[model samples]
Target: MSRLKNLKKLLTVLRVALSLVAACTFSTVSSAALEESISQPPDDYVLVRRVIDARYFTPESVVSRPDAAGTQGSEETWPDIKLRPSLNLKEALQSNIAREITISEQDALSKVVLREYGFGQKNSLQAYAAIEEKIVELNDLGAPENLKAGAVIKIPALPRMALSEPNLLNKYNKIPKGSMYPSLSKVTSFDAFNPVTQAFTEKPVVSGDGRDGSPLVIEHLWLPKDYKDHLGGIELDQSYEEVQAQVISVNMESESLAEDYQSIPFLSAEERMIIKSKLSGQPKLKPVLIVLDDGWPNDEAFYDSRKFVSEALEMIKKRFNYPVALQHPSSQSRVFTDYPKEAFHARSIHKSLATLVELEPSRVWDDQRVRVVYIPLSTAQVYSKAMLEELVVLRLIDDFMLGARGDPVPDKEVKAKRKIARDIVKRLKQDIGVKDLSTDKAIIESALVFADLYAVASGNPYVVNFSWTTRKREHKFTHFDFNQGILVSAAGNSSLNNCKSCRPNLAYSKECECADNAAAEERWFAVRSVSNQDVVAVMNTARDGSLQCRSSIVGSRSVDPLAISFNGYVSDSICGTSFAAPRVAWLFAAKLAYIPPQEFSIYDAPDKGHKLREIVKKSRQGGASGDQYGLDIKKLFEN
Candidate 1:
């Protein structure tokens, strides 16, 4: 009887062990399946994929839109390797200094030069003279019109006594009796790309008659499609047929924006009152436009560029009566190795906030509050559809899913980090008065964008998948709703010489398709400009006058009198449509002062400021194209 009982116990134990093993195997298999599911493409993207399919993907074959309402037949091509123009402002100042010192945002070039190269405070005049000499040296190299931070400039080697023959550029400063302002110039030195010149072209003798138009107006320009034809008045020989391309670049016209606006309820009575109070008087009309760029110059370039940008702002304010600010945040910060490039971009944005507060004291309404947005450049170098969608998902999860419910995530450490990030984002959002980031709305007036997004995109092959297309549409929608104040964009710099696909288009053949889809999107509304063309062309849509550039994506949409300068103070030498966007932004800011209360009310509407289409309605002027009227600001603003 004892042996039988023992056998029963052994059988039970064996059965229990077997059950445990089976359960363990089931759990392992289930976990593996879950991971596999996560690894696969999300359902939305399952039907579509990136052409390059990598972290850094570049689109191949950029052709102009065949059906585009702008100039057709000329296909713009972008190359795998970019060949941009280069100018060295730091080197220009090198001969005058004993050694160069890196500059900071807060440092004044005059004071710094005085401290490093001056004899003493008693010899202030002499120090000022030395600084003047350095300024002239910079101008010769086609430096940015303003003083830039984050570059290295020279400490003049000349003794204070030697520079005492009166500062050559001192007369340019227009500060009040007690304020000391840096020398600034409206004249740009950097040779801008000229579709007419077939090469980088300089301004043909600035008009002494002075611009009669509103300083705030933005002119969109495109690169010349046929360089030889424009410059030599002779058609150039071509090797291949033109490639028909379609670029759905973001197009934010007034009509689509108006429709978008109606969907959102107009501001409440209280909100309207608040807006009225803030923007009531002309004094409140101070429009703060910001020019943002990517890429940092060498240490030497940083010094010169910082000072140049600073001085340029002052100059524009005094001469054009335009209050424009600039912020070029680079991936390379002071401690270049410490953080990722994205961090630096965030820093640049923060810097723009600081700058706004400094430029206009009233901007501190709620502890240095300022509205901000993002406007893509012509090249689409600042973003990709995949990356942009990733950002949206991250924002939704962090701001709503995880934190909105006021519940802590299961992981304590992750929750803590997210909390910190959330705080920062919340602070900025409030400052900009952004009620919700979930949809595209214009709650902010300022914007931030990178020019390199297009430059980088040029290297990848085009993807026509649903995911890519949808993301792009979403991105444009976001920008459209991001700012109620205004939208400013750059017409890309892809021209015959720089873009690989452009050469074949000289013959007007159909062999390459390198159009930028971003340029075609309809959410683009505010202002856009190119560098070389004359008479800014308005697009086919009644509200499409906003589209500008010579990429052939916009058939016959050529504009004239567009101007740009090299950011010589920042780097060895580089120029692009990216730089032109900021210049246009500055111009637009100048016109803000003239905006009437009635016109400003557009922001309070659902469409925000979409009804304010001031690009094509404005009068035109002739200069390089001869005997034509110039862009008349008085008529555009007054009308």
Candidate 2:
């Protein structure tokens, strides 16, 4: 009996072990299947599928819509990689200190320069040796960042200070007063299939004369498709294609915005004294505008249909005499937002910057918060869609899976975006002699562009960035609605669609409705995100009319913006429509006397919505997220 019992127990243990193995195998298969079902652009990159069985994935190419419109104002180089001559720094220091510290024949130490640029101990040793010969007299210096590194600095071959950085990040500081401000500058420098040039082109400037403190008014002149032929009285050359470039810089007809009243909003443009009376203290108007040159000119966005926008600007300018203007877009930013999921990896800031420089502006204002948005000069995928399609015939990656999310990056997405980053580096090295671009190029370029632009217009102080909220897909951009944009969204905890206010089945914001058709939901989410994301920069507008979602309350920063946020209401509550951005704009104009613009692209700013909120808070009546339409204008000048 004992022997029989032992046999039974042993058999039972073996059976249990076998079942476990089967279960594990089943789980492994299931997980792989899920991943494969969603895996996008296939490995055979040569055959791109724009459609799944006759249903288009990417929208068929079309003459895109208009984009230029906004409040605005708004300009690099190549490395001549030659060996630097070595310098006996001690001797060079005897000369003019600042001049001596710059790159001269005496400072070129080939070996040291190569080493500084990271030629490795072996690769460019001889090149360094050759350059070191030129750096004869040395002016070994103290660290501008710190003296502890025991480092020697050399200038580029050019007569000016040219530098290659390879060290821990130096402490960054805000641009000091009386300095230039770099506004949101798009990508400034990068390799491209074709080099960017500013010399004469048939394309006319769409955004014109829209900068802070600029007294000039810009206007566009409607012209025929081949109108470039008549600009200089020479029918030079313009394709007889469907092209519309009618933009010109014009002068403000009235000296003060109040000179043209009755047409604009609050103050009369025809009466300057009216505005002067309102400015009890030191009152000055700094007119500005922002325009994105995404595609074709948007006539509907201007006086024709967007009369309200023009009215608003006029009202503000006339009310306080702050000038404003904006209009543009011909094709860019697509590279930043639209890469395929498998291929979309945020590379170095330098991977796509254009080398187009203009004479630096003479005066840069420092009142309004200015920020910049950079566009890469090259993405390889940008040159042509056909070329990109040919390169990616197989679909291994999904079309809309994401390359980067908000500043608080999700680990899973981060890992995936970087999965092919190493491959990107390898390709760049082979294509243009760069590796680790994600680390090396992108960040560096952003810093440089923002820094330079900031220097030009340091006056605009409190920055609200709209760069990272970018997308590549297509969707409509309806700036305001009955409710939504005006409210602070509560990050609700439920099984609802992330983007949808509630469930999908219900037509709109009827929270109780649920349309759980997985396939339809997937397709709906795949709409092009660019129009949905870029044009309508998300903002904090809850104070005046922004509704607050009960679940997601924003109470992070003390100086958080008291803009607009909604609160839990009954189903019958109709408030804080998704189209409530105007209140933020209106509030901004009202508080212009308090907040100044900075040119740096708010690179260090927390969430833009939060930053905007913080700015309002730091200002006079930015108390809390409640309605305060009767704002006090005096506290602005007091502090």
Candidate 3:
């Protein structure tokens, strides 16, 4: 009885202690809430995250709290100037005496022209108005009609001014301090170790001895001059400024139309859930893969109807890659076709990107700061072998805007759309090879490019689902620019030229009407023999997820075991080289994450693609061979 009484007393004391502790906890929470309520919130600029390496980001460390709250403060000191945009500042536009000038393909309402005509950054409104008047004068046939080729129009011939201060061109040229990530120049100053050769060099090596590698040979292909002329004719008459203005107009109209579009119009709630599920455990990158597919005609059901293509897009997102979808399935019988209106713009944009990267090799390292767009086979048909080589030497494009596609068709309709696309293409082409890109940095970096050459010909016609056929070889043509970045392409989906189901019997000979009976072996040579150091022609892996002696293309120069999606499922029936190409691109991007931009930039030195190629080659392992010919990527980099 005595012990029980003592236990009860102990319990009473324990209860009182617990209640006191709970009260103190509640009091602390209440005090914090009150302090938070009284304190001013941090400004958005203070909260904005700064990108460290263009690849890595770190949030601002600034903190806001009540004066009485004794929390530790951040050490960073900021400048006193406000970062917000200035509002309602009125400026006047001044124009010099004007002279008559002829408008030609070479003519453009560029910043230089604007400045020469006495317009400055402070005169944007006046500059825009003057350019608009020129466009209106050139387009005699009302809205949507293009400026005729060779039709000379009068323009102001103001005396060229000194590249004046406060000019728009100079302002754009100057990269503001703290605007860009810290320069990679310092990081890349040191040498790299080559594990394969056990030597210290500037960077890794791919093949053919260290920094003394041979020049890469790339096969150039071209469309008949007539075909190119037919497709590219629209550009013959357009100027860069005119087309750019038109593209801007179209985009503005698109934005207006999009205002009424349903949020998540094409994808359903279930589909969104599916996407979420797919993306759940995947690695996210700073850059998004912008899948630029062709859209069908604007029918309510066409975009609204939930379908297989939508799911396929989700699957693509699930492949540890993120996608920014621009268009979906086309109404055409096949997913990819020739001569689509959008194809012209896609091709033009690709050429523009390639040129820009070539001029500023540092652009290759700009992961999302720059973009990688994926276009269909229609775009690939425009490049002939020779034109491709020529593309490397062209002037860099300053800016590009995509031709709008998808629901909510613009009011001006197809004619307006055609005019817009043609003008843009024309502007892009005319602007090429004219600008002086001598000052652009040749910083080497890992770049990604995907060519969806489905049923396309590179001097030889490729049968649908069949990649191999007799191809015209142009071994003599080679380019050094191919080594500037990693160029991933698909080994076409083709088979052997057999008896019953052969394509045209005269594929390699006289005029034959059947599909060619070219085998995988032949296809391998056709695709892989492009002879570019950075080119990696990829073949689809077998259904069992292995790189064996399957019916897929086989060669020393080709890679294997790439997975493709049909309706977004890798196991689905719709499999081809088109799907395989992106996989290799993703692989390259993943490997690039491990390397600093400075490292890739250093390799971009004029020493040839040797440094860049070697870095890629050394990082790769688990191929069919220990030599350059192996296609497997089992253990790309050892931990």
Candidate 4:
């Protein structure tokens, strides 16, 4: 019996050794096959080096999928495997936990392991081998053959230094260089400004205007030409201004008749000529206006709605002799279907641009050098519920910190608190079945819009017209400091009572008169709510300068320094505060144009908005006194 047992043990050992050799051979063959498959990577895919070094995993860190079949003669089956916490490899290794995932048809073992471990794709052989061994050991996968479609596997918990590390394969999935869409993976900087002459050598000279004889070269870092070609093109026509005005009037009046609204009337040739005659001898100064709103219609019609944006901009250029560059969404946008109100969006944009350049051309500065840039608000509100919830919670956290700890919380504490908030939001989202709102495409598009806005603002003196608003009161993340320019935001149309003075404690005390006991009235509006000095809010007013009943009062002098503007028929059928905001934007642009380029340094001052407000106030007829300062276009230019 001893001799038989010894022989059987030797036979069992030999069988096991032979199986191990066969497995090694199979793994070698499978690796070669994987190499062959990845040799010709897809067009959208790119190879990336490993970001972090591989670390050792303890035995307890390895976990296996439960057997699908029950033990022999047993009636019980194992429960489905629960997913490990969404921690990176390093974190998982520290916690001694392994994540279980099922393999899909398109997944390669190497890519799967790389992505799962936060190592990114196209990792080096040495880096891949280290992680591969642990993954295979954890799931008892001897060969790549075990990684079949729908096969269950365990991912060894790995740690990544940064949580914001992006998967390279996912990052560059479809965005190629010079594509219509802008790249969001990297921070884009627009440092180079486009010269008015377009030629690098020929600098346009703006003489006179009480300068020191040196030529005043006005240059702006406008949107890139490639970006323009993709989103909207730059329209620069040198046709006689009067002739262009006549063409604009004829086109606008004819097209408006077909739309749902009454006929759109533009500045008549006679009216335009009279304005030109008033500024006949003034030196032409190039003033740029950036309009932020919904996208305009491309040549192709998504629907039968009126297509007046391109025509309106062209007419504005003709009437004012200014070049208009639009940064709206292209028809090729993936989220094109999301924007159902393009017609209304286009009208609002048109109303703003027209209010600034055509309808109320500054009498002091020649309209010849005006430049209008239209930037789209966004392709669509593709923000996920998770992101919105996170923002809401984060805002509350910030407010609490400000009230308790006071302003400027420490960076370390802020990061720690924010991380906890984000984790809470993530867990809640999973429990509530709220899908993440952001996609690769949406992120790229949104990033492009903001990047363009930053680029434009960084350049020459510019006025950004935000004729839109969001219900979210606090925009801690979205708030931008236009140090070189000013932001004119529409005080939303929600008709909520102003609660600018209401404190946090007041809301709980029930003494606040706001519609919802809000801590701040600006809470209902985004940009308007921001307490930045550069931002000026505007509300709607009748033709005679009486505040419109429907418009929301910002209730703060700092917010609504120049409060009102006429928002009527040619604006929107609804006549929103959207039209009112642009008139103020025009006022700023006109003031910028009035100042000599040598004195452009005034915009760099912190009190530039205040100085401009004072300058505008002095120009007001009767020097309008009260918080509700009505914007008078004629008086604005008289000073």
Candidate 5:
């Protein structure tokens, strides 16, 4: 009986031991399956389940793991893997972590997974395949077709080796070669005398005459019909009839009158005295009209237009004693016209000149005190699309260098920096020899051209009208003496689309809208921010006192008085803020004509906007509200 009991006990102990062994075997198999479920990282990289707090993951931080026997040990006995002194530990750890991104319409699967986050174009196909597979496994995408638009997915961390590999596609990574600007075959120098002549020095690619190697003719003298006839054979390339018709078209004569009555004869001495008496007390110095735009008409067409404009102004001076004779300093009326497409539009120049001379129907003249100077500095034909993009890239590099320094650099160093900037531009052009239309070249070139022209327009007490606007407004236009006079710029025609949130309002206003789909509000803010005492920005309004849908708004927050004018034609079909700006310029010129030279110096001082706002307020008409002021040519002549 004792032997049987002992056997039972022995059997029970053996069964218990067998149960423990079976449990251990099941646990081992389960651990293997769990390990296989989680994707393994590529060699030389560790899988980071979660990023440790950066404060605790310092260079002094140590990583600990179990011993090779897979058994936990005392803290001191566990291996401590110290980070290398040369390693950027934070960056290294961050690179190994997965990143989440939502696909954009512009994003391609290959670009996102391979070129953007994984190895670049220089990597092998096997490397790309590995990355794609890792991405699919990590996101459970199953297949490439499953990666649809707006889908969120995880990008697998890149291998450790990728950090050491240079990315050639990054423009910042490429070291610019020695003397980039000076060594280029086309670009010569960025000296103040002639900064960017790369596009101008070479013959224009477009087919046209009078673009290059043509003598520039400027018509400064406005001769009376009597003087023209006496000087006989003065070679008016345009017929007398044509000149008469142009004069009528510009509102120099009543269009309702007979053709025989259209001719403007010489004024009698009595008529001159009567006009002179009416202009008493105004400044003797003539106000300057600086037209900074694409080049004016070329050769004969240019001369004829100038002759007609001058003669028409002379007629006003003789008949009404208005200040018609424009001040000619050095006998040069047209300053810069070096581009190929200078003669593209004669009507634009004609309309601008006519607007400066007089406002139609109301017949309000610029008091005959306006002088004209043309600068052809706003044409996009000078550069290929590819060249323009290269220029922008160069500008970005320059901005980065300057921003990194964060200190005021000396003049000598500034020149050196400019040279480096030019060099980069030249090198980029060489790399991208292909010609294509640039996405943002027009805006970039507008700023560059204005900068160059600003230097040329300096030194004279002038009212400069820029019928253009650009997104780039931070350019340091050297040698531009803003003290000379004020700049009247058009508040761009970029407000066509209304902000959906601010419906029924033709344009976006800061008070009612935040942003638009086209980001036009941001652009409008940029345009308004550039305005001050020295720069007067004008917007367009319709005859009904409503803002033109296509006219950019000067936000209510602006301290500068908003100058709004009729954007539609009073005489011809021409319209836009382009026409509105010159009308404001003309009005400002009239105001400046009464201000003494000593008082005119105030424009150079800060807070000059106070005085400018006052001027705009005093001359403003009935079609304005709040901070806005509409232009009235008649109010300009008021005391």
Candidate 6:
């Protein structure tokens, strides 16, 4: 009885307390709240829960704050500066020119010309006026046109480019992991094809490889004056109407184009007159060069340059080994080069490399940095025999030889050829082991880019370049690759490519055609190859991502690239998939200690590769192609 009474009393008291609590809750919900008040608040108030307080981020060592009233102050430093056109003061000074010069709206062109030519005060004003009148009469005879806006304003510099290219030939900055191109430059004559002639004779000599090229000939051909006589004089196994033999020639000296515009355009007679009055000045300023030409050349017993620059850098670090580099997939490049140079410019390749370093590229627009453009649709030939047989072999096996007939390459038929490429890239790079390389460094790099030019242009500390230029695309070639990552490249050799295709049998080339099959092959010896950014080595970075190796260069279609021309030897070397940009980036790492920042400026290191990749990531242009990996040579040493 006592226990029941105690329980009833306790229940009554509990019920009374619950009623009071409910009344307070309802009142609080209906009333305005305060800092200490626990009731419904205004829209501005966001809920804050603190299970574990944090003042800093661990591992990364970044200072952080808890999500509370006091933590809203942290923000990106100077958000406005991220844009390209916004122009931070110093960046503005780096611009080509400040302004444009213009004449009045009602300016009369001939009247001004007459006045400038001393018409009125020339002792014979009537005669000068008569001359002007006669000139006007001639113009009237030609055609009756609007004479109100008569002044033919002379624009000294073209608006097509950003005025003069003397300073910033800012390339398409496509931030590594960011966006696509957003820059320009000067003194860059790197046009890829001749817009006017479109002939092989105008192309530049390639940087790396044997005189003619690899054993497998591509699309070009070389003919000698004695071809008819030589074949006629001898009894050959195979005969043709013209030259019948393919010979390998070697002559090393001279080569390629400048990406930025280095030439000065004529604004008026003033420029010409000034040159005649002044004495010869200093040396000419060159462009920032990059390249990569691959293959088996340094090993050949017969012909080799005075210095095999490709392997020259290895001498500096004989003990340390480096990472093995490989090609990424083409279908996945972020910045589509349509040419081939797009491959190595993989967003991750640069970003990851930049991450290793620590700095990043400045852009025109800060908000939306880069664009990643992924291309997953597979078509025809993507990989070169060298890349597929070499670095990718470990990734793939004999079961993946996909051609017109999807089957593996027969081991017995092409074992030797396959071994050459695989042997070169797959070895554990503990030290410089390759024979063709001149130096002792173990981390040898290769690419579609011309590393020799990069070394020469950027001034690598421990690098000797092996590259050259040429007049005809079908002539002998020169090339090299090396440890300390000296990259190289071969030009796309061909004739006037007037936008056409080959004959019925696919015997005649797009540029050069012949009546007979044998004649066409002989005529187009160093056959012109097609490229689109870094297609040279569209490596399968991870998930089938890629970058380009082929690019258009600085040269315009009206003129062939002034840079070195190159091509594969036989009909087999069809695509100009030179392992370019990556090779230049590789040399950047291998020769870190010896040289200063050359290709791109070296700033404070901040995950060098990451920054490079960030440039693309921020742009988000390459999309799927951004997945490929590459070295960030720009951040070798944090400036």
**Cα lDDT listed for each candidate:** 0.27, 0.23, 0.27, 0.37, 0.37, 0.23
TM-scores for candidates 1 onward, in order: 0.27, 0.24, 0.29, 0.39, 0.38, 0.17
Please give the lDDT score for candidate 5. Answer: 0.37
Q: Give the top-scoring candidate (TM-score).
A: 4
lDDT of 1 by residue, 1-639 (tens): 999999999999999999999999999999988754443211111000001101001111112223322222122211221211111122112332122445688766555655553333344443344345565453342442355678655343222211223233432111101100000111011133322212323221111111111011110111222312232311211111110111122211100111122121212455334333433334434343333222221232233333333333344334323222344334366312111122222123222223223433354332212222222111122221222232222332222211112222223223322332222222121111111111121111111211111111121100000000112332122212222233344333333432334321121233224433223332132122232222122211001111123222222134432222111011112122332233233334434444554554534433433343333224333233311222333333344
Kindly list the per-residue Cα lDDT of model 4 for residues 424-539, writing each as its tens digit.
22221111101111111112222223322332333345566656553331112232333456566676555443543332222233333442311144432233433543456665
Better of 2 and 6 by TM-score: 2
> Considering lDDT, which of the candidate structures 3 and 6 is the better prediction for this target?
3
In angstroms, how far off is 578's CA in candidate 1?
1.0
At residue 551, candidate 3 shows an lDDT of 19
- lDDT of candidate 1 at residue 471, scale 0 to 100: 23
Off by over 4 Å in 5: 1-183, 186-282, 298-346, 355-368, 378-460, 472-481, 497-520, 524-526, 529-534, 557-561, 568-573, 601-604, 607-614, 622-628
lDDT of 3 by residue, 198-242 (tens): 212221111111211111101011112122222221111111101
Summed backbone clashes in each candidate are: 113, 152, 25, 9, 7, 212
RMSD of each: 30.3, 27.7, 27.7, 26.5, 32.8, 32.0
On TM-score, who's better, 5 or 6? 5
Report residue 159 deviation for candidate 1 (angstroms). 78
- Write one digit per residue (lDDT tens) for candidate 6, span 173-272: 1110011010101001212211122111222121112111111111111222332232122121110111211222211111222244132221125423
lDDT at 296 for candidate 6? 17
Q: Residue 280 in candidate 4 has what lDDT?
A: 47
Among all windows of 10 consecutive residues in model 5, the one with the lowest summed lDDT is 245-254
